[model samples]
Target: MDKQNSRFRWVVFFSVLFTYLLMSSQRTAPGLITEQVMKDFDVTATTIGLLTSMQFFVYTSLQIPMGILADRFGPNFFLIIGAIVTGVGTIIYSLGTHEFVLFFARILTGIGDATIWVNLVLILGQWFKVKEFVRLIGFAGMTGSLGFLLATVPFSAWIDLLGWRAAFFSAGIALCLTGILLYIVLVKKPRQLFHNESVPVKDEIQPQNVRMLLKRIVSNRQAWALFFCHFGVVGVYVGFISSWAVPMG
Candidate 1:
């Protein structure tokens, strides 16, 4: 049972990993579609900026609330819903004939994208041992980097062959299928009871504690460096690789 459960946990890990890949791909897909989208909707450069920027905006603004909701409900719930919404949002974006509709589609995609990673952390915490958790996070980061990598050359070719609308819709269909698999497999896995037993739950946070936590992170030079490292490295990577790489290349 232990070995079987361990294998199953890894299965769950890959599922979430690929979902994270999808998240990364979705963020960058706008870059591939930028020129086509602009011509299709008859929008300006600023509007294209705003449209692509909306995903990050929704992702950044919702982190705190998403964490809270994940705590109250469950990480699995968010992962499933996020996948479904992401698919629906992509389909919506694919079908949009007007600028306003496309703008709203980006907002919807952002909302769905915002919920993914935090919940992934929670789900990983539940399934892996303490030491394994750190390694798993590194693996997740690597997968995310691959996502950034794949979003350009292959995705661009896909757009060329299928055209942007069909390409977006194909991804949406795949995402929805993955969401269904996630819902079926993890929700009722045979090892679910043991998985629940192994994972430790943290103490609930008081609203007031948020301030102290932020202050502590802010005061630490090491922590600040890490923040900037992520901002500089990951932020710049995503912005360029996902958004501008095709055009630049």
Candidate 2:
């Protein structure tokens, strides 16, 4: 039973990993569609910048709050919600004929994207031992890299064949289907799946401790170093690879 349960956890991990892949894919998808978007909306690159930034801005703004909520509740609920919202956003973006609709779709996508990674961390932590968790996270990072690569050449080819609307609409449907698969396969706890009576529920963080939590995080030099490093690397990638490079080429 132990071995069987342990094997099943990998199934759950891959389900979430696939969702994370979709998240990263959509994050960089605008690069391929930039020309079509500009033509459709009769907008400048400046407006395109705003369209892209709207998703990032919302995703960044919601991270802390979503993390707290996911900790209090559970990640499974939020992950499902994220998948649905992301799919809807992509579908809306595909069908949108107006600038206002496009902006709204981007915001929705950002909100969904915001809920993914922190929840992924929570899910992985719950399901795996520390060493296994570390290795799985590295795999997750590789999955994201694959997503970025897919959003580039393959996604561009897709757009070229079907145009952006059909391509993105198909992507949206795929995301939603992946969410359904996640719903079926992801168990919040190993005990839940395996019927282990000895397993204990994890303690939830209290609301009042948030201030202290923030202070501790703010005071951590290592955290700040990581924050700056990630920010610099992501900033350059988003600014160049995901937005401008395609058009320049």
Candidate 3:
């Protein structure tokens, strides 16, 4: 039984990792096909800039709302729903002719991508204790890094052979299927896994009721300092890479 349980946990971990890979692929798809998009839409660099910019805009704006939904409705629910929405958006993007449609599709994809990191973190917190947190998160980060690595080379190869639309179509299908699987396989808490163990009954944690929690978190000086440090470091790194790397290529 212990072996079976361990196997089950590993399966769940890999499934979540696969979902993250798909999310990363979707996020980077536009960058992979920037030249094709520019030619097909007959757009200037500025327009392409704006379309991609919308992705970041939507992702940043939706973070808080996605967190709330994940906490209130459960991460699996929102993550799966987000994946479906993202897959639909990718399909629409592949079929899109006009710039407006493309922009809309990008926005949807961004919203979908926004659900991934937060929900995964929340899920990890539920499954692993504090002692295991760093190691598990490191493993998750490695998965994300692998996804990014795949996006650059393997993804480009697929786009070259199949064309961007076909590539996106395949990706969309994968995301949709994975989302369904996650919804079916994922349980909200550890107690849900034990057949004989009595389930703990607790009040549903509402987003609105989280104001006090938020207040406590925000009032922590260390938290504020950590937030700014992360924001400054990550922001600078991502911004520099996003702006400079493609141009250098």
Candidate 4:
């Protein structure tokens, strides 16, 4: 990366960082709005459970396909589309009347959110050195956690003042703007400047490679071991935080 592009890498990082902030809000928003959702939708725990689960269901299911799309079309494609779809879905969620519509909105939001984390991983790979990747991810995790923190009291205050619809509506608009920021700042398959410039050239990212990637991942014993651990920890943890935590509150 030249000086201009080097500066823009941080810009790209922050853009994705901000996108993660809103993505966290979307993930945790249902928890915060449990009571409001229950009252407004006039539904019981089961409906709310299903509604909340809808997002995660789509989110989890789309990971492979999303990963393939990101690699094939470029991470920028997913990043841009993800933000746009998420924003639109959030707006729909805020405006939704019926349970079914809300369900689809949540699912759509999940699809959009699904594109994000993986795309960020790809972006980190494109911009930073391999050794720096983990640290950048750690920082990204911290930034995302900030959104979770905001989703608590500050978000509650927004709902208290504006009501859930207006609050979510505003967030949706912000998400859309974030998408535009991504379009402006994020370069598609940017040259790996954070790494050794003399590193050998590599094949282009392509759709066919996705199959090999999956095969490699599945064949790795350590990957399976870590998969089980992540499944038990992250899956349960996210499910609870994204769904049950607010109602518990």
Candidate 5:
């Protein structure tokens, strides 16, 4: 990689990392403020569960479609859309005064949140060598954990000081700004940055290709095993962490 291309890749890394951090924070922030939200909305715990569930439902349902779209259009396209949608959704949620509106907001947020993981992986593959990808992905996971931390202690403090609405409103604005930054700095692939003709670019996706990809993935027993494992472990862990843990504490 040329020095200019090399330096730009780190910028891409940090920008996308920030996007993931904000995504993680949004996922977990509601957990810590459950009681307050319940009181304000005159809602029961089950109602609050639905709020979290709405987000999760939309998020999980869209994963394969998001992956296909990211493959088709490039990760940066969806990243921009995701960031802005998340920001707007959060803003609406922050300003919401009714149950229906809140649910709608979560749904929007979920759609935006759905875009991150697949695209993040794709972008990493585009920018980094295979050896570096593993370490970078590990670091990305750690950054997500840091987002959980931000959503906990510091978020709690923000709620105490600024109120949850203001706290989330600020976060929404930050995400919107992040979207703009992504638009300015993010390229579809390294080809754009390095002017390297040898770098592979995505071809236009075809219906048959999509079907083949799906069919192959679906037929992979090992893939199914991994899917179930992730679904069971991460699903339960995220559910508990973002819904019950803080409230129970």
Candidate 6:
């Protein structure tokens, strides 16, 4: 039984890691194929800039709301839905030939990407104890970083060989399939899935009330500091990296 339990934990870890990598790949696809995007759309630098900005703009703006939704409806559901949406967006992006269609595609992708980090954190929290949160989060971060690393060089090569649209379509299919698999395999609450386990009562768990939680998060100085820290670091890195291929192409 102990060995089985240990195996189950490993399964959960790898499953989550694979899902995260898929999500990261989808998010970084645009960066890898920005040149193709410009050629296909026949757009100028300014337009491409706007479109790229739209990805981050929508994602950053919607994150708070996405987090709220993830809390109220379990991360598993949100993660699955987000992956589906992202897949659809990728399809749309592949089909787009015009600026408007591309804009819409980016928007959809942004919305889909917004749910990723929050949902991942939510899922991790359920599996790991609070004391282990930072370490687990760091591990997840490393996995995501590995995904990004792969996206930068190898994904670019794939774009060159496969053509951008084909690559996007392939990635979309992979993400959709992974999302379906995760939905089937993952349980948001262990107790809910394993009846023998003693689950904490509702009141014992943190409140799921969105407004109250937001109020607390917003009021906390440390939270704001952390938010800005994340924003600054991720924002600058993503911005530069997303635009790198554009000029090269």
Highest lDDT against the true fold, candidate: 5
lDDT of 4 by residue, 1-249 (tens): 442247656767778888998987888786888877888889998998888889988988999888777777788888888998999999999999999889989988998999888999888777666667778899988877787777877888888889999999999999999888787677433444444444345635534666787899999999999899879986787667766676333
lDDT per residue, candidate 2, 1-249, as tens digits?
Answer: 552247887888888999999888998898777887888789999999888888999999999999889988889888988998999999999999998898999899999899889999988887788888888999988888888888988888888889899999999998888777777776445447566544444544445688998999999999999899879986778656666656333
Query: Which ranges in model 1 have alpha carbons more than 4 Å from their true place?
Result: 1-5, 190-208, 247-249
lDDT of 6 by residue, 1-249 (tens): 221243465566678788778777666668776666677778787887787788778888988888777767778888778877777887888888788998898888888878788988887777666766778789888988887776777787777888888888888888788777777667543434565655548724564677787799899999999889878997778776766543254
Question: Every model's Cα RMSD, please?
Answer: 3.0, 2.5, 3.6, 3.8, 3.0, 3.2
In order, candidate lDDTs are: 0.80, 0.84, 0.75, 0.81, 0.85, 0.75
Model 5 C-alpha lDDT per residue in residues 1-249, reported as the tens digit of each score: 652248777888899999999987999788887887898999999999999889989998999899878877789889899999999999999999998999999999999999988999888877777788888999898888888888887888887789989999999999999988888777544447666545334633444577888899999999999999878997888788787778333
Off by over 4 Å in 4: 1-5, 187-200, 203-212, 247-249
Cα deviation at 96, candidate 4, in Å, is 1.0
Q: How well does candidate 6 match the true structure in TM-score terms? A: 0.85
TM-score of each: 0.87, 0.92, 0.82, 0.86, 0.88, 0.85
Lowest summed lDDT window (length 10), candidate 2: 197-206
Q: What is the TM-score (0 to 1) of candidate 3? A: 0.82
Best of the two (1, 2) by lDDT: 2
Sorted by TM-score (best first), the order is: 2, 5, 1, 4, 6, 3
Candidate 1 vs candidate 4: the lDDT winner is 4
lDDT for predicted candidate 5 compared with the true structure: 0.85
lDDT of 1: 0.80
Q: Model 1, 72-159: lDDT tens per residue?
A: 7889989888888888888899898998888788888898888888999988887787789998999988887787667787888888
For model 3, the run of ten residues with the poorest summed lDDT: 240-249
